[model samples]
Target: MQIVIAEDSVLLRAGLTGLLADAGHDVVAAVGDADALIEVVERHRPDLCVTDVRMPPTHTDDGLRAARQIRERWPEVGILVLSQYVEERYATELLATDTTGLGYLLKDRIADVADFVAAVDRVGSGGTALDPEVVSQLLARSRRRDPLERLSPREREVLGLMAEGRTNTAIARQLVVSDGAVEKHISNIFTKLDLPPTDGDHRRVLAVLRWLEGLEP
Candidate 1:
């Protein structure tokens, strides 16, 4: 697979470039900043993009912003983000789309080269991957909805996907349920959250986003 890398750290950038090239994958561009990253990506449109969460010129989430831009213009290109911290906000934003070709992993995991490469391959092949640490922290810090505490395990599964911007049809596909069943669960979710019934999709999404934001550290 052809890949483009965006990492401000010279050592890590060199290592990643060497490893991918040695594995017989084309390393089309290895850039050091998010602007350069975007320029190369827009120019080459490689098979996948691997970037650090923090990158140069301000060094504060430039890569994440670039990733969001890519989701807008080249939604099909796979994205894998490496981060030093387990920011649920970052993971949440990264996986906002229903598409599976997105991944977020902690940077320390790069030491396990084989596993890191496998994750890259997974994202490239259209699969979602999140660091186990990210999953645990996200679930732990979210609002303690005691009413959600009353949900059946299946209902809780549905709620998580809803928080991830999934449609009822997509949720049904994920849970292998009928659309009717998914709608029933969504109604239950609204009632439990005390959200008034709404006709627009944006209202429900806003409610969920606010709920998620309130749980942030």
Candidate 2:
């Protein structure tokens, strides 16, 4: 596989080049800044681009932003971002747009050279290779913003029962609550979930569907 590396650190950049070269992959170009990285990518159009999140000219997220632009313009070129830390905002944005031919691994997590090389190979071949920490962070962020998190414990139980095809009377019986109380809880659930009142049955079904969606892996 042909690869391009963009890292601000000279030693790390050379290390990456040597590793990829030793792994039987061609290092078409190794640049030290985001702008140079972009230029080299356009020139070589390598199969994969290995880049650091922070790079020259502000050193904030120039490399990550450039990676996004590269993915937008040349989607066929896979991107593998190596970061000192997880910049969740840009990382999530990149993955949210498209995950194919993409990878995000922390620098500290690359303890094994073979694993790092395998990740590069996998991502270069249009496969995903997210670091475990990255995956965990993404999942945590998703859960934090989950709509179901707004529901109270009782409301969540009511929703689960509703998803199980339980009527208000049955739900009340299961929860040891009066039918009127169950009705109020159901109304609150609908309101909190923002389920419109198009039709009573349709709204109930929609609420149940929302609950079911939250249960997805």
Candidate 3:
């Protein structure tokens, strides 16, 4: 896979470049700021872009803004954002549109090299890879008056795992339930959330996005 990296920290940028290269992937460009990231991405058109959520100038959401723009212009390229903290607002915004080829992971996840690489591969292949922390924060902040309150505790658990980009089989395994049980729970969740039935992988993403959007101010 061809990848472009955008990070203001010199040490972390070099570290990520070396890590991905060691994993048998090509690092096409490593840039410091969002502007350079946009330029490099447009020039190389890499398969994936790994970027920090904060960069240069004001040092607040620059990388995330660039990521949204890239997704708008070059919808084909995958994006995985690394953040030091869980920014639910930004995550919600990034996922508001098409959820394909999207990921938002914590920088601490880099310590788990294998998992990080797997997340990159997953997002690059047009899948979601949201950090567990992101899901937890979003769930914790959900308003009591929202439709999410209609779900049972078990259904909420299933929805959380789904938001973390887990497949039905994976969710079943994690919850120690049968695949049919997981499917039923998901069906209940969708009905309770009032999400229209969709026949695609995006239904899970859309359901999660609907829940997240409700938490926004």
Candidate 4:
């Protein structure tokens, strides 16, 4: 796949370029700031654009703002946005649209290189990727409805891991359970929480994000 990148950190930008190039994806252009990012993206029209949520001159939501613009002007262009933390406001904004080809994740998730690339691929193919922590915080803050209150202790544990964005295999590893059992727990959590029956990972994440959105102010 062809790609464009927008990130302010020099080390991370270089590392990401190397990672993507190693995966046989072409890096059409990479820029240091949001404005430069926009210019390169429009020039190259790559398969996907991965950007950081914060960039100069304000060090605020420049990347997200750029992403929203891309969604507006080039709706078909895939976008993956990374942030340093699980921000409810940011998550809420990103989830407000039901558009495909979008992802919002914590920057540290890049350490899991395979998952990171998978996210890029997912978004490029029109999907969503969100940090698990974002889901957890959202779930945590939902004090009123308490849809999750009925879960058993084990189910609650499984729900927490899912919110952390763990795959069944990874969650099984963490919980010391078989993959099959992890799958069962996830299903139970979904039933208990009334989550959508989307089998896709990112879509399931969006379902989780929707539930969490209710808790945000």
Q: Which candidate comes out best when scored by lDDT?
A: 3
Task: Give the runs in model 3 whose Cα sits over 4 Å from its true position.
Answer: 144-217
- Expressed as tens digits, the lDDT of each residue in 58-127 for candidate 2 is 9999999999999988999999999998778978987887889999999986669989999999999999
Which digits, one per residue and each the tens of the lDDT, describe model 3 over residues 1-217? 9999999999999999999999999999999999999999999999999999999977999999999999999999999999999998898899788989999999999999999999999999999999999988877866545788899999988988888889999999999999999999999998888777766656677789976786689
* Candidate 1 lDDT, 86-197, residue by residue in tens: 8777777777676578999999988888898899899988898789998888777565544555566777778788888899899999999999999888777777666775
Q: What is the lDDT of candidate 4?
A: 0.83
Distance from true location, Cα of 184 in model 2, Å: 15
Predictions in order: lDDT: 0.84, 0.92, 0.92, 0.83
lDDT of 2 at 144: 75
For candidate 2, give the lDDT: 0.92
What ranges in model 1 sit over 4 Å off? Answer: 143-217
Q: Write the per-residue lDDT of candidate 4 for residues 4-91, one digit (tens) a residue.
A: 9999999999999999999889999888899998888888888899999899868999988888888777888898988899777767
- Stretches of candidate 4 off by over 4 Å are 141-217
Best-to-worst order by lDDT is 3, 2, 1, 4
lDDT of 3: 0.92
Better of 1 and 2 by lDDT: 2
Candidate 2: residue pairs that collide: none
- Model 1 gets an lDDT of 0.84
